[model samples]
Target: MRCEDGHDDAAYVLGALSPAERAAYERHLATCSFCREAVADLSRVPDMLDRLEADEFARWLDPDHAVEPERPRKPQGRVKTFSVRLLSTAASIVLILVLGGGVFAWWWMGQQAPAEPVFGPAVAMSSIESTSPIAATIQLAGSESGTKVRMQCEYSVTAEPYNFKLIAYGPDGEKEQLGSWLARPGAEFSMDGGTRFTQGALARFELVRLDNTKMLVLDVK
Candidate 1:
């Protein structure tokens, strides 16, 4: 995604980075929560694409399935017209490249041992146990200075908004609030954080509501 800091994390997540670039980005990932979250957000895209077959994706270039153009309307001035086709061959090729070429690599991944995750080691997340209506998963990817935490939550019931904080407790009873958000119902909530405590050092993570209610808790696993 887009960051005001001009970080092109999309490119990073898409495997477009050179070796040196990848190393630098991983170093930056150790500290930048924005970039870390961007990585998590894009991590699933490749897996979704992994479901498409080469033959199926090739259908995008099938001329027979081309979308018929809408009725042409007279323009008042010298307006430009655009093609109505879903995708041209050249555009389709570029689309495949931008999708990280993972669709084509599906066969390769299965023929051998499992390959690396598209978004590196930080992509896989663990589930948080809770009896509440809220369900969520969390991941703690360690960094030299600390660990990058990613949380994905699903919530929906009413149109109301809920406010909450992600609290991290250190081994010695130290506490830290990673971040907070006003979550609106009918949507998923994603957040990122970095802490000095590695995954092993943290006692647990508590999703505490503004009213001092513990909505969810994730113990070390």
Candidate 2:
């Protein structure tokens, strides 16, 4: 049989396969390492289910009993009884290890999962001289690659052609020019821009004109 047919290992272990199909899969298992490993892995599922059923039965039989002593029996073959008990104990240990390892793996995967992005509260920009009509707010969102910036600005357009420059200053004096834009005169203008700096690494954000005159500055903490 083709290796693709090995996908029925779960059904085979659960006794869901027909007699003919089970015979064919056993023959295929002899030559297919993938199917063999799949069978070994899935075999524990039935053992776990069986353990659960046994626990339920025991609980139902004696709900109030804390510890029950084994009843003495007539001397059956000592060696045969010893061997059976040893094999049963070994099987129970293997099942516990398999089920415990699976639970630990699931917990570890959950712990390592990526968290949702958290955004910092938007901080409003304050003018240095107190007479500047330019208003702005800056916000930062944490991401896997880097922190994303969102800057919103409201400017009083008094000059003829509005030539604006948005700059982000890093904590270490590194400066990045975000972008530039133009707006019409005698009208209130708003602009949106972004930068690559993380929120904590940013020292300040500034909006200025082409002539190097600072229009607005936001001190970051």
Best by TM-score: 1
Q: Under the 3 Å rule for N, CA and C atoms, how many clashes does model 1 have?
A: 0
Q: In candidate 1, what are the lDDT values of residues 1-221, reduced to their tens digit?
A: 23343255766766778998889888777545556655775565565555554445556547466454558877735323233122233343355454455753464356544332222232222334433446677777776555667788876666468887778777877876677778777778887667667767878888888886877776764
Quote model 1's TM-score. Answer: 0.42
- Off-target runs (Cα >4 Å) in candidate 2 are 1-118, 157-159, 186-192
Model 1 stretches astray by more than 4 angstroms = 1-131
Each model's backbone clash number:
0, 0
Model 2 TM-score is: 0.41
Q: Indicate which candidate wins on lDDT.
A: 2
Give per-model TM-scores.
0.42, 0.41
